[model samples]
Target: MTELLKPELYAVVGTMSAPLHPSLKGGRCMACGFVFFPPQRYGCEVCGRSGDCLQSIALSGSGTLIASATVHMHSPGARPTKHGVKPLEAPFTIGTIKLDDGPTIRTIIVDANEPSLKPGQRVISKLVEVGSGACSILDLRFAPAL
Candidate 1:
């Protein structure tokens, strides 16, 4: 009884897993051989191919920042901090990256705190913790290449 309860307790307090995977969500397209991230839902939206189409594929995570911009205002229903403190200056940078795997995606750049940016810079995706303890959300974010 105690062992069963311990497992349950651990689950309740454990960190949440991310939904996307580099291998499972960003690899070769089964139908067209095109690799992408946030993998295709049902069929190939680009080639219009169907049947035995789009499958979970791995992504290289390496990409070039094609374009970027900062968002100064928060959208409606945005989650506030656990301590009730809103971000002092919640500026976020969004960019479309051309991954080596052959697909482009709009992703948040975590290292966008800098005052400036340039196109064609290298970036990599990473999992980031967005909030406190149980209420946290794991999100994909990009950072400048090391």
Candidate 2:
């Protein structure tokens, strides 16, 4: 079995065994009906209610891309590392997406058969392998739905 990079942020079910391919772990304010990502336990931003007022929910994986930018590096072998994370490779794209549910989030974009992204482009959540060893370490990513 593969390991999830962030089990608290999202969930992915096997294609043949489950219905939801991927879903974001989000939170909703039971009092005010406000929805937000990252499933925070703190007080809701829209209302002052906390504790029992916050409820965890599974959000749909579809969203619309608001904007995107690709980062490029100039020098080779000059990558910087923080903590234990290896420096990100150049030409990786980051996108600001507004989920269909209501909140906006920023995440890495991977080209999965879709063309260049533009504002208002449709995107969907997908799992990507990030580890290099025998055991697979899977992380979530946003990809164009075309």
Which candidate achieves the best lDDT against the true structure?
2
Judge candidate 2 against the unseen true structure and give its global Cα lDDT, from 0 to 1: 0.78
Please give, for residues 17-123, the per-residue lDDT of candidate 2 as tens digits.
Answer: 22345788899999999999988887999987899999988877788999888777636765432222234677788889998887898988997422478888888
Give per-residue CA lDDT, model 1, range 1-146, as digits (tens).
01111121112121123223222145455666766556445657668775567665545656788988888886766655444223324578888888766778887788666456679888776655554444544445678876
Candidate 1 regions with alpha-carbon error over 4 angstroms: 1-24, 80-89, 134-137
Model 2: what TM-score?
Answer: 0.83
Model 1, CA-based lDDT: 0.58
How many clashing residue pairs appear in each of the predictions shown?
A: 5, 0
Q: Please, what is the whole-model Cα lDDT of each candidate in the order they appear? A: 0.58, 0.78
Candidate 2: count of backbone clashes, pairs at least 3 residues apart or interchain = 0
Once fitted onto the true fold, the runs of candidate 2 whose alpha carbons sit more than 4 angstroms away are 14-20, 74-87, 112-115
Candidate 1 worst ten-residue window by lDDT? 1-10
Cα-based lDDT at residue 92, candidate 2: 83
